[model samples]
Target: MTFDAYDTWWWPYLFVLVAGWLASDIWRFIGVAIGGRLDEKSEGLVLARAVATALVAAVIGKLIVFPSGAVAETSLLVRIAAAAFGFGAYLASGKRVIAGIVVSEAILLTSMQLA
Candidate 1:
């Protein structure tokens, strides 16, 4: 019955957040510092590239299939159409990601209104 009474759950949540941040960010900072000493075309870089690609794919797949907001409320077909429109724009505009994103968002908004 009080703001300061988070009780048993608070410590675990705090610990997880702090630990996750430290685990991820510490190595990320070290990577930046050690980047100049590392080879761009190394095996480690290749593994990192693969992991990054997989994560990106997972995020995009989630967005197109199982979003978690107003976007989640929209139909899959609508989302796909919007994405396709945006991608087409990107291709037409010399692969400019920002332009593609803007056009795609506009398409999604207009389609949602029409629906």
Candidate 2:
């Protein structure tokens, strides 16, 4: 039977439930079923890691170079300095993600306040 979401309030919920399952859950189930067979040191996995790292670096570069809202108001030198300090903190903290992010944000906010 065909469901019309516009005709009933409950139909929208049903539609979303079914559509969401088909859109995401199916892929998740497929991944779970097949993912176990993949080797940890496979070339594909290595490439995936490299691509993910590149994407993250690209995003960080974008944020530093083209910030928005209040961050955009800060000078380029301040942003670069903040990023440098954060990177240093990350290295100093044994490559901790939280340390890098917190130090970066603290530097940015403090610079903003001072400027």
Alpha-carbon TM-score of each model against the true structure: 0.74, 0.66
lDDT of each: 0.84, 0.87
Candidate 1: C-alpha RMSD after superposition = 5.0
lDDT of 1 by residue, 17-51 (tens): 67667778998899888776778799988999999
- Looking at model 2, report the run of 10 residues with the lowest lDDT sum: 1-10
- Model number with the top TM-score: 1
Cα error of candidate 1 at position 15, Å: 6.2
Cα TM-score of candidate 2:
0.66
* lDDT tens digits by residue: candidate 2, 1-115: 3666268778877877887667769968888988657687999889979998998999989999998887899999989998999999999999998998899899889988888
Model 2 root mean square deviation, Cα atoms: 6.8
